[model samples]
Target: MEEVFIAHGGCPHWGKMPTRDASYLREQYPHFGGFLAQRKAVDPDGILLYGHLREMLGL
Candidate 1:
């Protein structure tokens, strides 16, 4: 289950169903900040961001 994965330091695939938030994912991914920066560059207006994705990216 999700708890078990979290207990073992499992990181969910960003493209799939991820229950963890950006704060938790930031710790798991080494280049999380860079990824965010890149995302911003690609979508400065966040036109593609909505719902869970917006919340997940903390935008």
Candidate 2:
């Protein structure tokens, strides 16, 4: 799973691409982070998980 995320170049934190790679992902897959904010907006859950993943991955 970790390798999959890294291979896809996604942040693995929010399951979204990083800011540096966001533009490219946007152009390639416009819906990349579209649901991120919406997901957060709907439910504030997983915030801690995201942070943990980010920290664990050293991203």
Candidate 3:
């Protein structure tokens, strides 16, 4: 489960079930902010973001 993964210092896969939120992911991924910034720059209209994606990326 998600708890087990976290307990062992693990991070969820982006394509799998989204058990962790943006805050958790930000901590796990060192370049989380850069990734978001690039995503925003390329898709400012959010054409590639919606529903769970917005929540996952913290947009």
Q: By TM-score, who's the top model here? A: 3
2 or 3, greater by TM-score: 3
Query: Tens digits of per-residue lDDT for model 1 on 1-59?
Result: 77888789776866776777889878888899999999999999989887888887777
lDDT winner, 1 or 2: 1
What's the TM-score of every candidate structure? 0.78, 0.30, 0.79
lDDT of each: 0.83, 0.50, 0.83
Candidate of highest lDDT: 3
Q: After superposing candidate 1, which stretches have Cα over 4 Å from the reference?
A: none
Candidate 1 Cα deviation (angstroms), residue 21: 1.3
Flag clash pairs in model 1: none
Query: Model 3 Cα displacement at 58 (Å)?
Result: 1.6
Candidate 2 ranges beyond 4 A from true positions: 1-20, 42-59
User: 24, model 2: CA deviation in Å?
Assistant: 1.7
Give the least accurate 10-residue stretch of model 3, judged by summed lDDT: 11-20
Off by over 4 Å in 3: none
